[model samples]
Target: MSQPKKTFNDLKKDIIDNQICTSCGTCEAVCPVNAIELKNTIPNLIGNCIECGICYANCPSASFDADDMDQKVFGRTRKPIEKLTGIYQKAYQAKTTQEDIHSKAQDGGVVTALLTQFLNEGGDAVIVADLEEDKIWVPKPKVAKTREEVIKAAGTKYTPSPALVGVKQAVKIEKLEKIAVVGTTCQMRGLSLATDGPLKNKKIADAVALKIGLFCMETFNYDDYMQYLKDNDVDPGQVTKFEIKNGRFYAWNGEERLHRAKLANVKPLIRSTCSHCTDFTSEYSDISVGNVGSPAGHSTVIVRNEKGQKILDAAIKSGLIEAILIEDFDKEETLVHKLAEMKKSSHQ
Candidate 1:
């Protein structure tokens, strides 16, 4: 029997009012009608609620089942040693071969390199986050169809952007056949739910051909984040890049250091939903990449399945990226594992 659908009121009681909404904006993305929207960093009903249940069902914070997701994505559950990182076929320290990408990207520019390779090989569209030039650090979702579009959307935004909204546009609006999505762990969970979900044939879900997840500890609210920076005497408008590292958050423009603050000071600005997130490596992604354990100009990539492995192999063969493989997992020495443990313990 088809289950009775839960409405946005259920979502409100369960997640939004509780202040645990991740603000990944999957709700807005998957909404069958343009009834939902995010105001500030919270989902608000802008139009009539239809009680479709897709928004609630697809929310990582609302309906995410970690164990069921692991089994669905990898065909197995986490082993004893794989508790922190979900399932991985291999691990590597990787970087982009293009100087332009490496110069502007957040970590190693590997994600951009991957997108370039994907688009070059006939990917119909890609969902990426783009910043408004007039609004400094503000971010919005973009459906990119060309290599230039992918390169333009490079870099990290400490504030969350609903990049998955591009999926809806790519699949339903543009009628794209294949699309790649790059997002943080929570957003990845939402994507995996829609794509590999029991309701698997959703148009937006079926259109996702590649999923690349970034390792994220947390994201901040936009207005509060900017005010915090302003309180530090930093102009948010001039800052070109944002990064959190070694106990500090930094704002930079090219080689010029604009401002920085202790990571502890930004606590009040972090999204409340971050504390509830347990998947640090985007365990459900086909490939997960981040800046945690790699060299200054490289990314730590956890290749999670045969699809990821094959893509990495082909990208390497094409000379689009350079990678060094890690033969075995190390618990004590790796920062990624340590950080993963830290992120997981938050849920307990």
Candidate 2:
């Protein structure tokens, strides 16, 4: 006998009410009908439901099987021993060649370079985190179809932006083809689930061309973090850049440090749902990029499959980016593994 199908109601009970939803917005994104909306970062059913199961089906936290999604996305399962950061063809320290982009990027500008290349190659759009015009450093999902737009969206905002919602809106609503999605680890998992889950959303699956994941230990609550900074006598306008390095978060104003907080000291401001996530290195992504193990001003890039490798190679050949073998690839992998284990043990 087969198990009963799950609907948004099940999603609400199993995920939202349980307080574990990552708020990646996959549910609202995949809903065939505009029946779902987010209320205070939690999804709620607002319209009539025909019992469609796409919401529950594509949810990252609804159920997750790393091996299953891996085979579906890459056509092969990872070896049991290659469990730390998933299967990767190579790793490198890379940076964008465009100085303006590099200067604005959170770390190395690799994501901006890759997205620019894809768009130039006729990809319709790429989903990215954009800062709201009124909210400094607040991330909102935006779909970029040009190099300038992608560059404008470069850099990291430490809050989750529900990026897959932007992907769905761009692909399903705007009728875009060949879209690339750049997201945090959980958001990447949500994209994989939409493509490969039992629901088999043909529109979403066909539209997505590339999936890039960013390294994330945890994301903070937007309001909570802003208030925390205010309480600590930090002015948002003084922050020229926000970064996490060596177990501390820093807000820099040109050559000056505006504010600094140890990672542990700011733990209380972390999003509650992040405590349920264990994917520190985006194991389900085609390629993962981060600054964790790489030196300052360079991104650690993990090439996971032929597609990812092909794109990286093309970008390098076109002079959009430069790369070199990671100086301490082993050490990089070790750091990634340590964080992954820490998140898993603490979350699970």
| lDDT for each residue of candidate 1 in 41-120, tens digit (9 for 90 to 100) | 58899999988788888888878788888888788988877888888877999999989888889999999999888888
* Local distance difference test scores for all models: 0.85, 0.85
Evaluated at residue 347, the lDDT of candidate 2 is 86
Candidate 2: how large is its RMSD? Answer: 1.7
**Residue 71 error for model 1, in Å?**
1.6
Cα deviation in Å at residue 183, candidate 1? Answer: 0.2
Q: Which runs in model 2 stand beyond 4 Å of their true positions?
A: 327-333
Model 2 TM-score on a 0 to 1 scale: 0.95
Query: Compared with the true structure, what per-residue lDDT tens digits does model 2 show for residues 128-232?
Result: 998888867778889987888898999888887888779878987899978999999999989888878767678888999898999898888888888988999
The whole-model C-alpha lDDT of candidate 1 against the native structure comes to: 0.85
